[model samples]
Target: MKEIQAVKSSLNAVFAIKDLGQLHFSLGLEIAKTKKGIHVCQRKYALEILADAGMAGAKPVSTPMVKKNEKLFEQVVMHDVSAYRRIIGRLLYLVNTRPDISFIVKCLSQFVQAPTKQHHQAAQGILRYIKSSPAQGIFDPKDTDIQIKAFSDSDWASCILTRRSITGFCIFLGESLISWKTKKQNTVSRSSFEAEYRALAATCCEVQWVTFLLEDLDISVHHININCFKVP
Candidate 1:
């Protein structure tokens, strides 16, 4: 408080500032304080997405993508491609608080330029899954070690159209998930080993950036562990 007041006093001559007390919402994310830890979710934003998709009362599904290996490129083109794009865009933002949808969203994003009816159905599947638990979010426990760990994997030539590999990774700051990604590789790998190596490289780059960020915040990472899960 004293430090904040001192900074405010110094800045008073230049600019006016108002105390917001605490962070409640920012860029569609909802924040709340709890006994366990800080609760962060986008329940309101999620419901808005469901309503926008016209799936407000749709039946929930046990999983986001039931048929992960289904051929996405062979489907018929969607008449309303903009709707699919909009839903994918919204899902991208929702991934900020819901990492569970990352992989599916990443897959769906590939068809943003020319989405099909099959793509729309897959997106609706995501909405149905969200309907099951709109309030689900990441929980950051207060008490945690200053450790950084990550795991990465890749599916070689997953995309039928481009034959590009898909890579997924998750990073944890202690026991709390801090970052994750599911992205298509820019280049095609000849073999699974090459794809996995590319995934590892991408994960390493992310970890390096995160390490620098934590250092800027004066938080030293004590333990670092990285595991690459190979798919046989």
Candidate 2:
């Protein structure tokens, strides 16, 4: 409060600033605080993205990406690195609110540097998924518990381009997600278990850091749910 007041006072000393209590909105996020809890939404931002992507009339989807749809370069490379990067960047920001797209976005982000025609198609698949879930976001209520939990998953040799397995994980606090990632492993695994284990290690580190953050808030997060599951 001192820091805030000091800044406000300093500004007031020069420009006659008025004190406003509680922020209702800032940046691109819509801020709403209620007796039940706080609700954060980017309705305007989501609509804008949908309009920008030409998906304003897009219907909702149950799943964003599919394994069968993930294809590699049979011939032409998209050759448009700039366009790929822009789409992925927008997708990354949307991940702030859309947890479901996190895995697919992470997968498509790999080819942002030298996006082939195949990569562009893969990227389009993700945008289509986003079109389906324009209204999604992280929900934190005042009454939720602090039980931090994580589920790790791995798909061995999932990438046809680099022959790399894609690893995925999600961490939750009580019932709400705190962090998640879906990424390709740097090394090639000899077997499925090796790929799954490395993915688990990545998630373990994430959960550890998350635990420390919670501890700083005087919250004790149990580590009992740091389990790994494999998908063929």
lDDT of each: 0.91, 0.76
Write model 1 residue lDDT over 1-232, tens digit each, in one string.
9998899888887888777788999888899987778889999999999999899989999899987666577667777798899999999999998999999898889789888888888999999999999999989998889999999999999888788999999999998999999999999999999999999999999999999999999999998899999658
| Model 1 poorest 10 in a row by lDDT | 67-76
List where candidate 2 sits over 4 angstroms from the true fold. 1-24, 58-61, 79-82, 116-118, 230-232
- Give me the candidate number with maximum TM-score: 1
Please list all clashing residue pairs in model 1, or write none if there are none.
Answer: none
RMSD of each: 1.6, 3.3
**TM-score per candidate, chains pooled:** 0.94, 0.80
Supply the global lDDT for candidate 1.
0.91
